[model samples]
Target: MSSAREPKAPTRPTSRDYRLTMYRTRHDAAVRRLAASLRGMPADIPVRLAKPGSNLFRFGGRDRRPGLPVDGLDTVLSIDVDARTAEVGGLITYERLVAATLPHELMPTVVPQLKTITLGGAVAGLGIESTSFRAGMPHEAVREMDVLTGSGDVVTVCPGDDLFECFPNSYGTLGYAVRLVIELAPTMPTVALRHVRYVTGRELFDGLAEHVDDPEVDFCDGVSFTPCESYVTLGRFTIEPGPTSDYTGQSIYYRSIRRRDTDRLTVADYLWRWDTDWFWCSAAFGVQNRHLRRFWPVPLRRSDVYRRLVALDRRIGLSRRIARARGQRREAVIQDVEIPLAESASFLDAFSRHIPIRPVWICPLRSTTATTPPLYPLTSGTYVNFGFWATVGLADGQADDHHNRLVEQLVIDHGGHKSLYSTVHYDRSQFWRDYDESAYRQVKKRYDPTGRLPDLFDKVVGDNATR
Candidate 1:
């Protein structure tokens, strides 16, 4: 483990509190606005693109750290129900996307668990879900996009285009995705959900792996509540609407709250079911105690409750303030590592022994489904993504930092790639060992030669190279 370093002081919040409702579809106006902003800014300043600031982890500075800003990019530009495609502007939230698509009996093939995540963030970060085993990442579903380049060029990027291929995991370093033509999938009226339980970790992993190639399964995810006990739930679209119930409104379906066996759920209800208490994984946030997690219905919708919880820490200003005041991070860590199928059993065992992060989420992702390989490092073969999200202990320098590095090393050693959505402690060399730095640099140079956007290396590993 590396030596413990003091937590840096908290600067101004990078993301300003803004509302997407202020503006409507204006792609042409947005293009001209972005072009003018880029033209006016100095060449050396990197440009920053942001959403409404509800990400569970920080990818880059919320505000433009070394750059100029071009705000109000979040808009749904257009929705083509007949073509089953949506032309989404930069920074549009998944919630808005879902609302628009549901009315047309269609939805994006893959949506991240959280509705707070932006379409662009999912494209740039790790956006995988139970359905990912078939549809791949959210970015893969994008047919094309209109990008406002750092060099002040408004170019259309198709699936195979250089800019389009490298856009995922670029963290807006390449340019701002002004308009995205995303492919949508036809959705059933309801989802036939089945919960399968296993007594052992090996059994759970193997069972989940077997269904990766199953054509019938529309969505699949596993949860590890303890070292041994786990449950894998598989859902398929159903033409027949099962017993209708409003599960999304008032229930706490976090992993802890979910049953080992369950019934059917509406398509929309099942999609955002984990919104309450993050599938009971918020136990790490002192919400694990059953008593604290159960709150009376305040008339607020299920989506509102979960959205508030996701932003609670930031709104209260407790964790970051404490870290800044004490030079230590006391908040929980969220990470997802994509592990090859063959090594999962042993890797899960190693995780149980070395890390105690609990209520772990296991999701399968397909390598073949994704047309454009994400800029982030992902193993080539089909893999299982282990979502190790929890607050093991306080980041009092040595212990937490050591634990984090150990987890990263475990992922690398076991043929896995760590998702860069959370705090990335990797040095430049370590990052490149897992990522393709040369390819990233080449793409950045082509689209953003003036350094208008920050490079992937700077965003993930920082400017200073570490041993």
Candidate 2:
């Protein structure tokens, strides 16, 4: 045995380790504070979250009650580069998550199109993007979650748990997620896109179905400009470096789809390509005009900014007033519905014949697992999510929800389900029937036995006051 002791190694923590420690400390404190706040609230009073903004299109009456404070919950807690797993705050937006992970060459398995869509919102309310065909919805990527139940207790839930299975489309009626551990996927420096044009909807669906399972393709989506014109855009990750196009400035991303056969974008831009123009809805604000776009500030060109403008218009009823002044009544026909791949063409045809909103967004998705979520029971086959946002003129005697009702019936007839984030016109019995009432009630009863939060039907389709 040597008498002299070997030199001791330094015990100081690395920068990344220190940061992760602080993040975890902060998250734990935040969760405790939120739980206490929920407990302090009166039992009879219904609770609601005080979010800074909302992506939901159902512009319901404001909940006058004070909201639960969630100040410190929006953050990326930790990213394990080796395991490709991220522990993030539920309120953290995908934009921040992307910013944090991109440097590590990792990203969430399925990142929604909009930058402001929070991870919790995406998981609880459901979200889809081009990658959904293989990766499934945002909830599917979550390995575990810490949810603040309506009983004012925090519990960790994982796959195979009843709460975990039913939580996706529960829309916060059960409880709110505070922290989630989600899986990540590797990424390259850039993405190469091919805009393949088709003459008809049938041809477009046929072509799109072929690429859904293509191992070479990493992203798949399409734009239907009209009944006669459609284009399926296929994107693949590439290490090949090239001069990528910039759509944040004078050029626009959606327009590029029509004008170019091929395009390239940095991974960040590729993920948010639709957000730059709100999927071309910014044209309604005249930002697409060559002259106006020149003066528009680059930083203000975002989906959230335009959404606020739309909200303002809704608050003041400005668009309704303008249309009424012009002797026309317009119904806002904004909705996203997922139809089976086989029936997508028929739905599109009926939609075009009735709604007249063009440039429908088409993204295909499939269940990554054998069993489907109970709340939004999508079968184990492929489905096409059709998103259209535009106002259509209502004839003199038409109900305000005439177009929306038509859409609901169309979805039902086509063996599809409509996303509840937007306006819903289904009757109570029918709504519960479609959403699986028995399953939802069981989960809701267990998580929120006292009915602290509004029921799913009440939250999405009930009176505006409850929403």
Candidate 3:
């Protein structure tokens, strides 16, 4: 065994303060017998197993609540996985679980914004994605869940059953999810990669809706970015199995899926590319920031992209320019703002008019049916999420603040909201606007009446989740 242990940081909090040890064993969780050994430790902090390298560890940051406390941490007990359904450890990342179930030809129905999220996180928190349009949030993918209740016991919640309505996106608020049993779509061999370009916001959004509505597009959708002048939107659809005229189906592992192509990549490389955000954000930010990442947003409008498609060619020149400038970033805040899908075009136009921030890019996330109400209430209909990734200069703080206010206003104006998954120093009103208050309160009152999860957020839902 490796003698090296994780460095114990004196500054890192202990269970005494609701901080627990986070563990990552080489193969399995070494934490199984922890309940007995942790008898003397602070009861507040809970043990969590980090998703073993899979990005889909959990849909949202809260789902994998690894090391996050249960006094505030919510989990139910006993997980069971069968031929039709499989129960997974809440801490199970998507990759391991997917691979484990491969022999059975089954996969989780709903995944997260990114595949790296954990199964528990998807069931409990990872809410938005293309799969949502049809199958719904990762929770809708679940047929039943084995949850550990606040009273130190377990219970089951099944779809269409009496105790079926536990809110999945509550971030474990209803209970700690020990096991989640979800259904799977038939396994496919390869996905057809379709690439196209859009010219305006109206066209971009309309095109997305039409494309995502198709079932064969297993992972329907594309990313937009500005290569030279106009925004270019690339759409991808998973090809159905048959003798393909183009290419045969190959198992796409994550590594090959995530790549920094000025064009397209396999499933895995496209998902985890170190430069994906850069690629994803480049459409609005200008490939200039590649000084930091290879990928940036791909713009949706053709006219919005740079005239030249020299993203890879211009790397050297851009890098030199950035180095010469020194200290100040030539790029902007990469501001990440999201508005509902249906409300996208209007909000996009409104936000662009109000905020002077140039090269503002948009990333959309459609609402799902299985979404829980109030907290992450299922919208009356689908709402498109527009991410305004603003590229600003440090000198652009005024612009940043100005756009942030625009963000706050737009979020409220649209009946749609922004991304809570990513950090965006928001005000209480913004969070309240994004989430439902009454639903949050009811869940908070039920399990964590002591208010131990306040360590959870800085502003919204009472500003304090303390026990």
Candidate 4:
């Protein structure tokens, strides 16, 4: 410790601050009635809806937000999952979809955290991590989309249509992702679990790069540790039957991707990666509650955060236990930003050098698109990218401010743009830097003549939607 006689200095809050994005905050009933009244046009306006709750946060990819109304986007659709596809209303969470589709042997290759996520939300903001190298991004799974545009009209776009590509990761800024026609994955009863430890970020990434090429490998990644010491490299892949299959050390058949299906690992051990389960209050087992509100959008970088994250991952459970005993929520600003696959290394370097490292994960965005073109964060041709975010405990806003500066510069350095984002308090000029103005001006002119969507999203990257 430094000399205590020195003056006390100021500190920053570890939490990512959120502006109750509810302007003119209306109840679900009123919003639904209003949305219902405004339906039947070619454009769809943005409105909050009601939901149960999930791990995927719209703002920070942490705790779930209150649900909202998405039924008004449909056209006499009565069911959830169809024969060839699922006509999921924007409201349904990823857990419900997975549960509904399991019987059909159809897996929605969305964010691995499927137990709680929205089909529309996932499509609007794409993510395909370990499985992405195999399946591509979430948008690729969409068969068709019924977008609720700002023009007060609902437009249906499919694979061959012009409006098909702008659907995913655009966030809610380009109106709501009212409905989706998602593709499915095959069913496998058991997954081979592999845990290999590494000492450094390079070793972990190299290991991951090596394992991704194997055919049986379903998902693989390097868990936090150091390049000089031990780290967990966990993987889940399809299990094949034969004489060799019987000789296994440890494996499990997980119902959902949330936790490791463990026949032997303790609850704490099983959920070593599922940190939220430990952070939240649950009486189910002796789980304690740490009350730090979880949600903050932080830019994701790959290389730099990998090792720092490993160290944090190891301590989350124990720290939460202590916090719960003390009756204080663990304050964490979970910032998650996705970049193109090629940018992962450079971005990660920026993060490790700039921000306090938290747990990070990699996701994928499809390379091919019919209408949506490539820019910076918005890449073209099938590609993969990862996200880096931090979960810290603080009381002042300095941590958040730091995140802002890092992300702001990151955007410029990476030559990228964010789509349909939930900005904290940035200016229009910063947003405009990511997305251009020409396409947005034309589209704004045609649809929202009063200029509503731009306040939510900067501008469009294409001319087809505007026309």
- Clashes (backbone N, CA, C under 3 Å), per candidate, total 6, 0, 94, 37
The most accurate candidate by lDDT is 2
lDDT of 2 by residue, 80-162 (tens): 89999998999999999999999999999999999999999999899999899889899999998888887777877888888
Q: Write the per-residue lDDT of candidate 3 for residues 1-467, one digit (tens) a residue.
A: 11112222222323232212332121113222322223333556543433333221111223323343323112211123445565445666565565555445455555443434667666655454434456655676676555544333345556643223435545554555655567665444433444445666677778767766655455543443332222323324344444322111122121222232223443433333323333243333443343432333333212113212323323345643764478554332323444567776677667656655544444334544443545565464655544444344435345424445556677778776543443344566656555666656654565445543341344222213211
Candidate 4, residue 421: Cα displacement in angstroms equals 5.9
TM-score of every candidate: 0.83, 0.95, 0.61, 0.61
Give lDDT: candidate 1, residue 133.
Answer: 87
User: In candidate 3, what residue range of length 10 has the lowest lDDT sum?
Assistant: 246-255
| 1 or 2, greater by TM-score | 2
- Which regions of candidate 4 deviate over 4 angstroms? 1-35, 39-47, 50-84, 112-114, 160-162, 225-332, 339-343, 363-377, 380-400, 411-427, 452-454, 458-467
lDDT agreement with native, every candidate? 0.69, 0.87, 0.44, 0.44
Assess candidate 3 and give its TM-score to the true structure.
Answer: 0.61
Cα lDDT tens digits for candidate 1, 24-99: 4244556677778778877765555433355645533234343334355566655677899986776777878888
RMSD to the hidden true structure, all candidates: 8.8, 6.8, 12.1, 15.7
lDDT of 4 by residue, 66-136 (tens): 23344333221222335546655565565566666666655666444433456666666555445666666
